[model samples]
Target: MNQDSKNKERHQGRSFTNETLFLKDLVGFQRIKYRYVNVLGMLAGLLIVVQAWALSNLFAGLVSFNTLSFFMLILGLLAWLLRSVLHLIRDLIASEASRNIRFNLRKKLLSELTFLGPKRSVIDEDAALSTRVYEQVDALDDYYSRYKPQTFMVTVVPFIILLTVLPISLITFFIFLLTAPLVIFFMVLVGHKAANANRKQFSVLAMLSNQFMDMNQGLSELRRLSRVKDARERLSSSAKAYQSTSMGVLRLAFLSTATLELFASLSIAMVALYLGLGLLEKLPWQLGSSPVTLTNAFFLLLLAPEFYLPLRQLGQDYHAKQKAEAAASGILQILEASTSDSSTTQVHLKDSETPQTLMLFDSLSLDANKRTRLVSISGHIHEGERIWLSGESGVGKSSLLYILLGFEDSYRGQCLIDGIDIKQADLSQWRSRLAWIPQSPEWINGTIRQNLTLGLSNLDSASIHDALEKSKANIFIKKLPNGLDTKLSELGTGLSGGQMQRLSIARALLSNADVWLLDEPCASLDQETAEAVLETINRVSEQKTLLVVSHDTHPIEWVDKHWKLTKEGLYEVA
Candidate 1:
């Protein structure tokens, strides 16, 4: 008896909440909100009557041989029909409620995630994140729609069965009541241990799946390092761990199943034992010969075994609950992280034109890593002037470009644009108003035209070609088989380093922003080509607010002002 009670306590309290995991635990959430759960509760109460009526009549042999038996069956069909329709309706409502709950919760979690992204939560490998979002979260659908309602049905069914039986026969009723707690006791105790095992297996599976996804993403890197065989071995180990744990769960589950059946059979056999003796006149009442009259004992006999059927099911569902618990814990961690970040700091972006200014530093410092710092910094430029920042080797020249680009996390003072703070404004919108082309900008698999027309509608292709012609990019595109529409493969097979840079400049020129932040605008070019590119930069910077971070010491001399970054700080040199 104590053992039965112990099992009951194991599944007593499993919680799933927090914005992330809440969506995954929709099954539990729906039961709490089910307005019709009470109505379903009443149906569960009526089920005892339905079972008694159906089983009693079936045993009574009211439908004797031939047409006489058939007549009795047709006449008694109404009672069976009531039972069928009620169960059907109850099941349908539970299914619908579960579906609604799961969908709404999933949608809510996704929306919250959107509000906190790009920097809030990063997916190192998006494939795993996406799989968890769709697949792992999908594991809850059946649980919500089926197992959740079943949980309630399981809880209410046994007691209702006991309640109906007690009035008809207290002796048999107390016995049913007494042994049920014992079976349930074993179920809870063993089921708790099984749930824990299932939890561990599920975690390992999710981890394994995520790791394999990452392995696939970095397949190229792995291949280069000749580590593909090692990666596969690791995956195999994870799979084995999952399988071993799952088998352990299955073993516990079989024990649970056998235990539920054992106690249930024992209880029903007692009822049968009691009734079999009653036939020999052990009790005061005599056994009826009429099918309906004697049918009572038969239905009672059938119901004994039926009462434990769901409890038998408890083992498998306890595992499902275990899976839900695992998924819930993982998702909750994500929600807590997002919530904490949101509560701790209100992130106002860098483009809001607040009182704080967003001007360029006189000189910005740079270095590769540890030894990198400011060496040459020159003074500021007004709204319309085009300034060029230049320096020698190992200088903080490129670092100056990062400072203006807003990638650097730390800077000595504020950069103000017209007395407005750069940090508060939308950097995206601000970037939209300017063109930036780094020395070696990355490219995707696309044509030169696609790179230029990216995110822009109604762009003039003629202007695109003109910008390309200026950067000498048009020369390479024209040489391709498809000309401007050539498909650049993933690894950039068709274009040279110089050609890629030229296309980047063309993209920048197409943007036509107020300010052009050009870092090493004419790098990695032959002497003659570098001269032409510099000529184009001088022409383009005339009306634009250009801040050129360059390593060139050419003769043209068109820079209106020069800022040098030194150890002292940024100051104007020309």
Candidate 2:
């Protein structure tokens, strides 16, 4: 079998780690917050017994028509109220804990993503990664809040109820004990199936989400190529698969609930029958020394259902166990993908300390998707040099940039900075000394000043205005009512394409990096705007090293070197 098929088989098999143990490992149960949540839950379970005992006494008093019946009823109501309060507190604690855990998981996931950089190629689609990181991580809420604490309750609560029942009648206690295992056994059997189904369901959900995002993004291109129908059909297929798997999961959950209900009802009924017989003195032989009093009978009857309540709840939450397991599987998979391979050696450095001097790319090569994109490419990018690199659309221009940023590890040959191997340098420190401007710049929904000065702190207005002016972005900023303080929608939607590019250029310039990398900097802009941006870039390149990757042949009088990347290698242009 192929690797993917084997992976699927393993994922669907009955080989998962213990769900509770996995959660505990991720966020230790020894944490003070989680301990508080569990303690509250345990207290709530103990309250069930108090509530049931009070209700039983009230019932017995009403049957006897005693004057104390009113007081007993009031006590029962108070016990019920206290139980509700405990439950509410436990729920609030669980919610707070779940929120904290989700926050931590998201932070950890983002850190790993930053470490892996942009070229990890694990999920291939941003939508799929987002779904896993956002939705799948959030799905862990019920597992930690409900399923985990519930598991503890299932273990402790029933035994506590059993202790209360044993003193009244050992016969009733034994009957409860014998039938309890049947409910749990069936639950485990069905839960195993539910877990497998949930794993496949989540996989399909991710697949469908990725397809929908890709279709939406490439709709224009698909329509232009007359393949819109094909794209739509594939998306529909994935969506249908996800829907079918989801329904199957629901059916299993319902079936498990029904089966547990049947077993628990039977167990309760058996206990009730035994208690009633003992009260009527209908048993052939004695099971306990004390006769079954009216008070004891009612208590046992009330406590029987309470004994099974925790188990019943656990059965209901079996689906959550499955969901959490599936989410954990996806999360662990991403974490494993972030592990550094042997090909790249990481060296630690003090913050912001980067190597200086010209970087040499010697006999560099990379193969992706069975196609050789770069072959024996060799070149030098000296400090304080203005270089323009031109390449055809599919000649791996962006891939080379990724290499310099230490984002792509699956490549051969040496990238040297000051005669030290790039692999041995600290990537974070190296990145801190470089600035990148992509073909499409990303913008958050924030003020223009916030977008420009994202990573840096404490920039005076004069410096901000200076960078903006140099990039030619001040032209439009002056027209705006708020200028630098103006709020922008996502991706700077209110701004023209050229305006956004200039703002990105301004942001890059503000970084004050020694080396600047530009990927198709003026792509999709008008000739006038492109020329203006190029002129700004040319003026900035006088001091800093510049690596400009573009298809534009606009004259750059300030550039010192020019190269064109072809199938064989990079060639210096005459």
For TM-score, the strongest prediction is 2
- Score every model by TM-score: 0.62, 0.78
Candidate 2, 1-574: lDDT as tens digits: 4333322322331233554555666564336766776687667767777777777787787777664666667777887788788778877777777788888777767666665566645445667787889989998988878887788788878878888778877788788889899999999999999989988988898888888877876777899999999998998899889899999999999999999999999888887777777777776686543367788788888888878888999999978988898888887766555323433445543332343456889898888778887777888876777788887887878888888887676778987766667666766668877898988776778999999999888788899999998888999999999988999965575688889988988888888887899889888788898888888788765678889998845655568888888887899887
Q: Which parts of model 1 are misplaced by more than 4 Å?
A: 1-48, 61-125, 221-225, 246-255, 281-293, 339-356, 359-574
Cα lDDT tens digits, model 1, 1-574, are: 2322322322222234442345444445565545475466457556656756665665577433222345435434654576567667766776777667656656655644543333222432344455455555665655655566566667777777887777677777888778878877887887778767866765777777778776775677899999999998988998898899889978887877787778778887888887666645565454542212256677677677667766666645655665565565555544443321111222233433333323645333444346756553535566557777766755666655555554442444555444444433344455677777776565667876676788777787688877887767777788888988888754456576567667777777787776788777667677776677777677655766778887655534787777754455655665
Model 1 is weakest, by summed lDDT over 10 consecutive residues, at: 338-347
Best by lDDT: 2
TM-score, candidate 1, is: 0.62
For every candidate, C-alpha RMSD to the true structure in Å: 10.4, 7.0
